[model samples]
Target chain A: MAITVRIPTPLRTLTGGADEVHAEGATVGAIIEQLEANHPGIKERICDDKGNVRRFVNVFLNDEDIRFLDGLQSPVKDGDTLSVVPAIAGG
Target chain B: MSGETPPWVKGALRIEAAVLRQVEADALACYPSEACGFLFGPADDPPLLDEMRREDNEADKYHRLDPETFPRTSKMYFKINELRAVRALEEGAASGRPLKVIYHSHCDAGAYFSQEDAATFASGGTLMWPCAFLVVSVIDGEVRDRKLHVHVPGTNGFRESPLTVIE
Candidate 1:
C-alpha cells in the first residue's frame, strides 16, 4: 500500500523539503499517522492543537475535496495520491 | 444615493457609485469569512450590483470565497442563486449586453488572484469575457481591500485592478 502524499509549502519544514512523500496506509488517517511517525511535527500542522482539522487546510483525495466526501476517514488504496492544500491568504 | 465608481470601470464604462458602495457594504457584512453575490447586468453601462449574499461559516477558506459554500459541481459551481444568475444572463442576451462579470469577496486578504481562483475561472462554463472576478476583504469587518480581475484570453488569463473606496 504505497501512497504518495503531497505536502504544502508551509508543511515543508517537517518533510525536510520534500514536497511529496510516500507512505503506506490502509486509510487516509493511517497514512497521516505514518507521516507523523516519520516526520514528528507534520500532524500538528495538518490538525489543530485540539486534534480537529484546521478550517483553513483542505485535504483532497485526488482532486475531490474530502469535506464533501468522507472527510479524514476517506479511504486510500494502494498508489493513491493525497494532497494537502492550506487556504492561501496572500492576494 | 452616491458612491465611488467601480475602480475597474474608468473612462470606458463607469459602474455607478451606488452599486460600488453596495459591493463594499456587502463585503463588510460577511466578516471572518468570504462574501459572494450576483452582479445583475446588460441594462446599464457597467453592470449593476443587484443581489448580494453572505456565507458566514468558515468551512473552507481556500480562496477569496469559501469553497464549501461554493462547491465544485458539473455545470456551474457553488451556492450561487441560479435564478438570479439566469435572469441576468437572459436579460443580457436579450439586450445584447454581456453580463460582464461574476463577483465575490476575499476577507482580510490582498487583491492578487490565486491558483484555486484560476482553476474556478478555467472551469470554462460561464461568460468568459467582460466577465470579471471581484474580491473584497473585510479586516475586522472593515473593507480594507477590494480588487477586480478581468480575463485576458491571450495572456496568463486575468488582469487585476485594485479598487479604492471613496468617502
Candidate 2:
C-alpha cells in the first residue's frame, strides 16, 4: 500500500528537508523501513536500537494513536495519511 | 477528587524528541543550574503529553539566595510566573484538554520532583489537587534525564506517584 507520511521540521535534516514522503508497505514497520531505505538515518530518529518506537515520539494515523491500534504492525490502506508528530516541549 | 486514577493516564504518559529538544534548548539557555517552568495543555483535548504549555519561570529577586553567585538562578526565576489558574481550566473546557501537567528543570540533580514540589501540588489552590508534573535535569548544557510524577488527592493531602515513559 502506498501512503503519505508527514514529517516534522526537526527531523527534516534526515529526510533531506522533505516535509512529506511516500512509501509502499503493508504494515507501519514496513512503511518505516521503506522510509529508511529511501532516506537514510530517518529510522534512527523514529525507532530505537531495538526497533521499538521511542517514548519521546508519537505516531498518529488519522488523528488516532497507533498504540491503541496495532502499533507498528498497524495496517495502512491506500490514501491514508500518517502524521508523525513529536511532542513539543518548548515553552 | 482522586483515589488512584481514572484509567485515562494508564497509557498516556510520554514526551517527544521535538518537545525534549525544545525543552533542552530552553534549559541549556539557563545552564549551570535548573530552569523551572509550567506546561499548559491544548485548548481542546484531553490531558496528555501533547497538551503541555510552558509558562514563565519563577523570578530571580524572589530567589532568596545571593544574586551574585547564582545569576542564572536569578534571571531564570525572573522568568517564572504564577500562572492564571483559570486559564488552564477554561482552556481545558474550550479546547477539550485539561491541565495536563506542570514541568520544571533541575541543573545538576536527577530528573526527580523534590519535596517542595509535592507540597506545592498538595496545596490544592490550583486547578486540581491531582495533576501531572514533569522535570528535566540538565548538566553542562546536556539533558541527563527526565521524570514525571502524578499527584492524587489523598486522605490528608495529595499522594505522589512516579510516571514512566514507555517506548
Candidate 3:
C-alpha cells in the first residue's frame, strides 16, 4: 500500500527538506520501516529502542491519533496521510 | 531579555489589545498551572493576530490516565491536546486563517524560552511549525511579562520577536 507521510519541521532534515514523502507499507510500523530505509536516523527519532512510539511523539492517520487507533499496527491503504507530531511541554 | 526590549525588536508580531488582555487573563485564571492556546491570523509578512483559542493541556489529562510516565503535573508543563490542535488547524484552514502563534504561560518564571521548551519544540534545529511562540509569565496570579520568539531556522534556537500591541 502506498501512503503519504507528512513530515513535521523538526524531522524535515532527515527527508532532505521535503515536508512529505511516500512509503509503501500495509501497517504504520511497516511504513516507518520504509521511511527508515529511505531516510536514515528517522526511525530512531520517531521510535525508541524498544520500537515503541516515543511518549512525546504522536502518529496520526488521516488526522486521527494512532494511539487511539491500533498504534503502530494501524492499517494504511493507498492515499492515506500520516502525520508525525511531537508533543511539546513547558511552563 | 526579560523586561528591556532588545534592539532587534523590529515589531515582528502585531496583536490586538483585547486579545493580549485575554491571554493574560487566561494565564492568570489557570494560576499555579500553565495555560496553552493558539493564535489564528493571516500568513502575511508580519502576522496579524485575529483570534485566540484556548486548549486544554493534555499533560493534565494524560497524568490522570498514567501518572507514572506522565509524571509532571500541569504546574510544570503543558502538552496541547493533539485532537484540539488538529481541529483548530482544520477549522483555521477552512476559514483562511491558519495558526500563526502557539502561546503558553509560565507560572512563576519570566517570559523567556526555557531550554526544555526549545528542545521540545525545535529539536535538532527543526521547528514544528513556521510560526512564532509567545510566552506569558504569570507570577502570583498576575501577568508579569510576555515575549515572542521565532525560530531561527538553521539554528537550533529562537530569537526574540517584537510584539506590538494595538488598541
Candidate 4:
C-alpha cells in the first residue's frame, strides 16, 4: 500500500528537502523500512538499535500516535498519512 | 528569575501585552508544574506573536508508563503531544500563522535553557525546528522573568534572543 509520510525539518535532508514523501508498506514497520529504502539514514533517526521507535522521534498515523496502537506491528491501509515529528520535551 | 535583555538575539519576538499576560497566567496556573505551549504568529524581523496554544504537560503520563524511558515528571519537565503538534504545524501553515515559538515555564528555576532543553531542540547537533524557544521562570506561583533561545550556529546549543513585549 502506498502511504504518504510527513517528514519533519531535521529529517528533510534525507528526503531531498521534501516535507512529505510516498512509500509502500502494509504496516508501520514495513513503511519505515520502505522509507529507509527510499531515503537512506532515516530509520536510524526514527528508530533505535533495537529496531524500536526512538523515544524522541514521535510517529503518528493521522491524528493518533502509532505507539498508542500496535507500535511497529500496527496495521495500515490506503490513504493513511504517517507523520514523523520531533518530540517537544525538556526539563 | 534571570536573563538580561539585550538588543541581540537574531531579532525581537514581539507579542501583545495581553497575550503575554495570558501566557504568564497559564504558567501561574500550572505553578508547581511546568507549563508548555506554542506561540503562533506571522514570521517577520520582529515576529508578532498574537496567539497562545496551551498544551497539557504529558510528562507525568509518560513517566508513569515507562520510567526507564521518560524519567522526568511534570514538576521538572514539559512535553507537548506530537500528534497535536503535527496538527498545529499543519493548521498554522494553512492559516498563515505558523508556530514561531515553543514556550515552557520552569518551576522555581531560572529562565535559562537547561542542558536537557538544549539536547531536546538540538539532538545530535541537528536543530529540530526552525523557530525559537521561550523559557519562563515561575517561582512560588509567580512569574519572575523569561527568555528566548534560538539555535546557536554550527553547534548543538542555543543563544538568547531578544523578546520585545509591547502594549
Candidate 5:
C-alpha cells in the first residue's frame, strides 16, 4: 500500500527539503522503515532506540492519533495520509 | 551575564497592549493550570504581535497515558493539542501570517525555560518555529512576571530577550 507521510519542518533536512513524501507499507511501522530506506536518518528522529515513537513525537493517521489506534502497528492502505507532529510543551 | 536585561538581546520584544492583556487574562483564567497559545505577526525584526490564538492545555492526557514517567499535571505544564496545532499552522500559512511566538504560563514558578521545555522546543537542535517564546508566571490567579526568549542558532539553546509592551 502506498502512503503519503507529512514531514514537519524540523525533519525536512533529512527529506531533501520535501515537506511530504510517499512510501509503501502495510502498517505505520513498515511505512517508517520504507521512509528510512529512502531517506536515511529520518527514523531516528521519529522513533527511539527501542523502535517506539519518541515521547515528543505524535503520529497521526488522517487526523486521528495512532496511539489511540494501534500505535505503530496501525494498519494502512493505499492513499492513507500520516502526519508526524512534534509535541510542543512549556511551563 | 547577570543583569536586568541580557546583553545578547538584539532588541526589545514588542507586543501589542491588547494582546498582552488577553494573554494575561487567559493565563489568569486557567489558574493553577498551564495555558498555551500562538502569536501571529509579520516576519520582520522583533516581530509585531498581530493576534493571539489560545488553545486548551491537554497535559492531563499525558498524565493519564503514563502517570509514572509523565508525572506532571495540568496545573504544572502544557501540551498543545496536536490537531489544533496543525489547524493553526495551516491557517497561518493561508493568511500569510506565520506563527511568530508561542506563549504559555508557569504556575507559581519564575518565567524561565525548564530543561524539558528546551528539549521539546529545540529538539534535534532545530526549532519548529523560528520565533520567540513567552513564558508568563502566574501565582494565585494573578500575573506575576513574563519573559521572552529566542533560540540562539548554532548554540542549541535559547537566550533571554527584552520585551516592550506597546500601547
Candidate 6:
C-alpha cells in the first residue's frame, strides 16, 4: 500500500526539499524503512539507537499517535497519511 | 499601557494591545507552570498578530514518562502537544492567518532565550518554523517583563524584535 508521509522541514534536505512524499509499506515501521531507502539518513533522525521513535518526535498515523496504536508496528493501509512532527518544546 | 514608546521594530511583529493582554493573562493563569501558545495573523512580511491559541503544557507528562530523556517538568519547561500543533497550523492557514509568533512562560527565569530554546526552535541546524518567539517571565505566579526574539537566518542566533502594540 502506498502511504503519504509528511516530511518535517528539518529532513527536507534529504527529500530534495519536498514537503511530502509517497512510500509503500504495510506498517508504519516498514514505511519508515522505505523512507530511509529513498531519502537516506532519515531513519536516524526519527528513531533512536534502539529504533524507538525519538522522544522529541511525534508520529501520527492519520490523527492518532502511533505510540497509542502499537508504536512502529502499527498496521497501515493505502491512503493513510503519516505525519512526523517535531516536538515544540523547551527547558 | 499604549505601545507608543521606544523599541518598535517598524515592520516586524506588530501586535494588538488586546493580544498582549491575553498573553499576559494566560501566562498569569498558568503561573508556577510553564504556559505556551501561538499568535496568528495575516501572512505579511511583518505580520500583525491578532489571534491567540493557548496550548496546554505537557512537559510534566513527558518528564514523568522518561525523566532521563525529558529532565524538566512543567515548572521549568513546556511542550505543546504535537496534535494540537498540527491542528493549529492547519487552522491558521485555513483562516488566511498563519502562525506568526510562539509565546511561552518561563517560571522564575528571565525572558532571555536559553540555549535549549534555540535548540528546540531548530532541527539539525535548520529552523523548522518561520515564526518569532515571545518569552514571558513569570516569577512566583507574577508575570514580569517580556522579550521578543526573531530568528537571525544562517546565524544560528536570534535578535530582539521590539513588538509594537496597536489599538
Where does the lowest 10-residue lDDT sum fall in candidate 6 chain A?
A6-15
Candidate 6: tens digits of C-alpha lDDT, residues B1-167: 11121122222677798998899899999888888999888755335888898998988877777688789999889988877776776676667677667889898899988887887776554555656789999887788788888766555567777777888
User: Model 1: how many Å of interface RMSD?
Assistant: 15.5
Regions of model 3 farther than 4 Å from truth: A1-4, A12-26, A68-70, A74-81, B1-11, B66-69, B83-96
DockQ for every model, please: 0.03, 0.01, 0.46, 0.54, 0.52, 0.53
- Candidate 6 clashes between residue pairs 3 or more apart in a chain or in different chains: none
Over 4 Å off in model 5, which ranges?
Answer: B1-11, B42-46
Lowest-scoring 10 consecutive residues by lDDT in candidate 5 chain B? B1-10
Best by lDDT: 4
**C-alpha local distance difference test of each model:** 0.55, 0.57, 0.79, 0.83, 0.80, 0.80
Q: Pairs clashing in candidate 3?
A: none
lDDT of 5 by residue, A1-91 (tens): 9989998877888889888999999999999999999999999989999998887888899978787789899999899999998888756
Standalone chain B TM-score for every prediction: 0.60, 0.65, 0.86, 0.90, 0.85, 0.87
Query: What is the TM-score (0 to 1) of candidate 2?
Result: 0.47
lDDT of 2 at B148: 69
Residue B43 in candidate 3, Cα distance off native in Å: 3.6
Q: Give the DockQ-based CAPRI class for model 6.
A: medium
- Tens-place lDDT per residue, model 1, A26-71, is 7777888899999998887678777656644567777666765676
Candidate whose DockQ is highest = 4
Q: How far off is residue B24 in model 6, in Å? A: 0.8
